[model samples]
Target chain A: MKIARHLIAAAALAAAASPAFADASTEAFVEDNANEVLESLNDPSLSRDERTALFSRYMDEFADIEAVSRFVIGKYANRFTPEEFERFQAAFKKYALAVYENELDAYRGNEVIVEGSTDRTPRDSIVDTKIPRADGQEMSVRWRVLKRNDGYQVVDVALNVNGNLIWLAIEQQAQFLSLLDRTNGSVDALINRIERMTRDVVAGRR
Target chain B: MLCFGVTDRPPYVDIYLFIEVLALKAGQAAHICCLQHTEVIMKTVVSALIALTTLTACATTQDTTDTASGVSDPFEGFNRNVYAFNEAVDKAAIEPVARGYRAVVPEPARDGVHNVLTNIRQPVVFANSMLQGNAQASADTFGRFLINSTIGVAGIFDVASTLGVTEHNEDFGQTLGVWGVEPGPFLVLPLLGPSNFRDTFGIATDRALDPLTWTEFESDPDLDDHIAVGRTVLGLIDTRARLIEPIETLRSQPEPYIALRRNYSSQREAAIRNGETEADPYQDLPDFDVYDEESAEGTGAGDQ
Candidate 1:
């Protein structure tokens, strides 16, 4: 149990402390969406609910929530029954959407610029972007863009810390797995935790 | 030993008294800047003043962009140098010993050591939790300490966690943050690595909170020193062993200093918020940096 906690923390710490590179189109995809999001956040015409609705629409269009859900569950993905996986994926999507919605609220009106990118594969790239704070300092926000048959979808957000890539999906995966470990790999337990987390986010308690 | 004939009072009382004096100094330091400016420059000036002796190791920079990554790294030149020095030391001395410790000690044994180390710190955690006005965390810490110390056989096993009283970390640094003390300038101590002005004082307060710091043995006067030293060394080895992969990953980064600075800020922010407002993706993770509670200093470890 201790090892599990440490390994997950290490993964998160490692990711937080690492950095990576991305491709051109990937960078454009992330940059355009990020700027648009900022524009929406800064627009005084839009009500809070309206902005949240737009954010949800953007997430639905830009994020591959299904692929990320499966990846986050790690080995347990194979173990879950088809029905359980479906239920888990739905719960996870709701949780992810709520989390991003809450997180995005804090970065209203911040200017996002694509610094550079590195394409690890033909279909995958890590785009490095910066959100300039009020103090003229830039906060690194790296997007992991993946090319789908339809178009490019964001799979993860890497907040570079200590030169490490703190990937959003990977961090969540550790948390999910840790919960599963404690609950003896019960799918229902994970679902419950995700649902609770989502509720917390929606209620502004998280 | 120096307190032998200086006072008829117990030696441990003198240690606590000394800590109280230092605490007074820290309070004064806190009053000077953290309470006034609530901005960057004043805090930096104060931190620089107090830590002047260690400043010789860091190259001073006049850049106004101290909070470049939204983190006040006023002494980045010094921090980077010390970071490099710590890496070299870890690579040369700590890393190899940690590797050896990992090779010799099984995972289960190491976990036992980790649990025991954590159990030992519960008192301090409990104290901070109470200070932070978190009744639940305070109760949980107390329960964990009582249960682990007894049923778990001096915390060789985490029976408290099994009983569903999960552990949470609360150091004096976090306590201070909760108390509205702004985290001052980002600092990288020679061996201690990443920290800030407010947390620096928090570290001292935490040590003062720990019973081990003031505990003494009448049968063998030197026993406390031996225990403290042994615990510090063992903790360093254990933490290094857990962080071998992560540190290597950090080394592979193009700009490690920037990465560390940004991440440290985020991590500290998350800790202070107690997982609210800031998403704590690593809440269950062990206190990688907090091993510095004693004289121990090293990076974190946990393999995937």
Candidate 2:
């Protein structure tokens, strides 16, 4: 009887099948926007500030920054007051922008191809891509898109750096948590570190 | 009844058959007891066989995938031990020096060093490309080397790339693969992490082919030895420094060994394929999901 029940459950799971292909619109959406961002970065006429602003706007438009920010904070979310959370999010955006903005020039000559996508769950999908390098190598990038009430928003970006698939949000979580731990689990300490790091980046300090 | 315990030592199926035979010869009352015993034993035997068959099927599937991937690691036990040792060495010695090198060197200077090393490698690439009968790639590689050496300021700047002389990265292992040599058992050398038997052999051959190795030290043999040592040390440091971020990312994986193995094998296979679509070794492996329960929780707590 137990075996029969197990078989039935397995069959049910197999029946509620996910489509092999990712949602076409989502794939197109990511490819189009990623190209736009790359083009903006490559544009010689655009000033540094203008390019940064463009990147920021597009990033905010496509990326679920709030979801990422909350996710990074993890259980430490309770430690932050609403204002503190808002400040941290702002700081995070600046820090993330600073890091990515510095890397814009590196992406200038690369070609981005959206290979395909896989459904992670009912709500989430992963769009796979390959960025061919100048040195005759290829890098893989995956964008995690979550379906929201509005539309699909990118919650995370993962890079196959060398061979490792590194998720941006996960990396940030580690960094943020370490800072918090160092300050005796204080959220204020992490916020300060973020703000300081953002300031340093803005000032062109390493 | 004495036979029952003895038969239990054998497989349940054998015991069930034995009980059936006994039931045929025994009285009606004894036969009824045997019948009940056989029913219970039969169910157990059938379930056990089903489980055994399932396990065998799963094992066979795994073996098929491994075979299809063309990445056989017969010395997995030894390789894993070596891998662990290499990781320890990296953490203890190699990583600190690499980190220090990165901290001290300016970005452009580091790039210059990387460019120079890459330029030096072009001759090896050209030779291998020629060996593989890829004339166009060989020409391109030779052109890049010549242009970069002369106009690119000793290859400190990649001016050849601007002039449409793109890189053709070939190596002896790839050449061997092109010539239909099989990549034998996967290996992990002491410091050099993931490689295979064919690639390991290729490394030796490539070293022999290097111009630097053939340079005559007619006078000052000690200086030559020192120079050779310095070159190897610098190369090691440069490679390690470049890999710092990737290694850290790899270490963050739930199963670093498996992840690294998959990554290395796939990357090597891709290199061998050279932009040609081939069956991906990593295709059957589970997708890397960031929000997988264990990873999500672990990453959130900074525990992994």
Q: What is the C-alpha lDDT of each candidate?
A: 0.62, 0.59
| Interface RMSD (Å) of candidate 1 | 19.4
| B109-222: candidate 2 lDDT, tens digit per residue | 887876777787677778888999988898899999999999998888888889998676667777788999987756665555576667656665666666765666778766
Off by over 4 Å in 2: A1-206, B1-70, B219-223, B275-304
- On the 0 to 100 scale, the lDDT of residue A197 in model 2 is 55
Tens-place lDDT digits, model 1, residues A168-190:
55445544554565578799988
**lDDT by residue for model 1 over B225-296, one digit each (tens)?**
776766666666765566554454344222345545545655666666764533433333222123223443
**Winning model by DockQ:** 2
Candidate 1, residue A203: Cα displacement in angstroms equals 45
Residue B139, candidate 2: alpha-carbon lDDT: 89
Off by over 4 Å in 1: A1-206, B1-69, B279-304
Worst 10 residues of 2 chain B by lDDT: B25-34
